[model samples]
Target: MADLAHGKPGAGAALSGGHGAASRRDFLTIAGNAIAAVGAACVAWPFIDSMNPSADVLAAGAPVDIDLSHVQPGQQIVVLWRSRPIFIVNRTPDLLKTLQDTKDISLLSDPDSDVLQQPGYAKNWNRSIQPQYLVLVGICTHLGCIPSFMPQANSVSPGWLGGYFCPCHGSRYDLSGRVYSGVPAPYNLPVPPYRFVSKTVIRIGENPPDGGDFSLDSIEQI
Candidate 1:
């Protein structure tokens, strides 16, 4: 449908380096994202370039191969696909528990993923093929502002068990990208079709072997 959040990471995201060894990087140019003014405290970013098919990312919507060996647990990286930002988070074990916490479920608008915001394969509590890793089309469904990756408990506010927060309108999503109740974003963040090429490498824009041909448009919203 329409272009997704085409800008820098959302404002005020409290970031933490997964391995703390990643080299510092400058602002990356995403498909449709602008060099957003991410404020001061959110400046340290370490990114890597992935190998894409011969087809240009904007032209053929080619599959992108990301080497996640360097992504330490509790860290995340961003890539571009079809001009949209793809957020890949290497979830930590403790963060995984928050997704299943009853209290976490109680705060979600669709903890069951019943809204079709993700493909059938991802229609579950964890919302990904693997619970340890998460892939989301990093755009807020409300107004297309990229949600800041707030990965610490209560990072945004009290009892906030680490998730993406859209400062634009206060919409909050869990680690699994499930939308929270009473939020402006009616739908959860869209889960892109992806499959693990290896234990540490993921190919975005492609589905799991058994996922059939899942279309990005099939989701209810971005």
Candidate 2:
């Protein structure tokens, strides 16, 4: 496969980060409410470097560990990391195959993840460290709108293969988070710096074991 950042001939975009302490309490509350509005529970974050993630910690780009033991295939859970929605999808075998098919990926704008939208380890056909799990920033590349998870086949349109649908502007991304060609969204969904801590645990806001010096800020868009 061609390199998204190097082999691609065009210039790619740059990815788009603070906080305080009473001030710290207020920030956490706001962060908690932001998550609540999205229907996600604010669980205590256990980062590899820190036992507990305070509002100040998350605001400062600390990692967040999420338990995926209960997340079944085809189910996705949203977790807040660095105050942004991180989408974790437990992909089924069928979805994995779809992401690898040449015909399917040909319809995407950046099938090879050549735009540096993801970490070095996640620049694959699946756009993830593991083929069965997909981690991405829930915000759309265009206008930063949160894209709705549309996993069911044909749920958004006739013959839809299943993925995310940005209701805000009709931008569509395949299950692998690759944007469809000709869409208003200029690039694929930004994949955060993440690593699988265990079989059923993921640590977001951190680099993968083999991913050296890769940061989310290096992505083409966020």
Candidate 3:
């Protein structure tokens, strides 16, 4: 999630660069904290002391839970899951429309998300389990640079419809992280296994309750 409402809110999430925790004592300390509102464009995630987790939380391969209740609509917050940057956005209704709009889809390389790398609930028009919240691995498929969250229309180029831009190679993606045709990126951004533990709390590095064997390793790229 990037610049929403064309303003930078300096968004922050609960854990920055945490690998995952093997024990609750290390990871559950901030279960009640909300993801601070972040906005504007070209998302830059500098660690904040209040939002950062302790070093022990970096233990690998356990579920990472985040409180997303305070993430304002249109705000995008980035958190590290298994040391991979995860983009979580509270997509507003208007943003949802852009994902569904044909005019916008026409510019994408994979509008239908037909790529097998996107399995489970992500292989759809919106590329998410729900229409409102979007979760994606925030690395550019072209060469692994973090794509800037430019949600403002025309923020990166003429006719831009609010999505991600990988400045490293000029690759573009839609709000749903679908790569654009003629861009250097070939596939949509990968969606990690995640599910809502509660209405506002999201658990990353694990699947939703109904999720069946949707392994992250099955996805060839991050």
Candidate 4:
């Protein structure tokens, strides 16, 4: 994997104290539209002849299906894949604009994604195959702790912008899961290999039909 072109100088220096972690009810309420499920029931295994996949296969990490139909713009939901938290967010038009802005990109540690933090298909500005949907591993890069989904702008700190915040270490990431320049995390959140099975369903753990030579294991981190 390629290293970050811009070396981190003041990493972890911008830690602030203001907001506490979001309550579970608040998270569910925010993601009310984003109903999701995990395991092989969500996948379509072309190679498998059996109608039912064995429990072992699912336990070993079979692709899961995510329903995007209910997810409204600007909302997000979390799903588990291979025992790792997967963040699926529906980005609004205005939110997408923020990601493309030069001013916002300049604040990221690996704005251009020179490093192999995600699949080639997800190396774009939105870090996803589809611009409206963002899929990322929820674990913080600094530590094994999970980051809270503080989507509202400045919810954690002043000028926070909307994104995930790691209360454990104060690491901040953009809505696209890109780590901030001055955070304790060294790399961006990892995007798992996945593709849209339909307009409303996404199959995680499988590469996109149009995407070539991409794999989750090839990422810099999980």
TM-score of each: 0.72, 0.72, 0.72, 0.72
How well does candidate 2 score on lDDT at residue 128? 90
Report the alpha-carbon TM-score of model 4 versus the true structure: 0.72
lDDT of 2 by residue, 1-222 (tens): 222443455533221002322344455667888878665332423333366666776577778889988899899999887778999999999887777767767788888888988888888889898888899999999999999999888899887888989999999999989999988999999988888899888888788667887877677778
Q: Which segments of model 1 are wrong by more than 4 Å? A: 1-58
Better of 2 and 3 by TM-score: 2
Which residue ranges in model 2 land beyond 4 Å of their true spot? 1-60
Q: C-alpha displacement of 95 in model 1, angstroms?
A: 0.3
**Which residue pairs of candidate 2 clash?**
4-114, 5-114, 21-24
lDDT of 1 at 212: 81
Model 2's TM-score against the true structure: 0.72
lDDT of 4 by residue, 127-161 (tens): 99989999998999898789998878779888777
Judged by lDDT against the true structure, how good is candidate 4?
Answer: 0.82
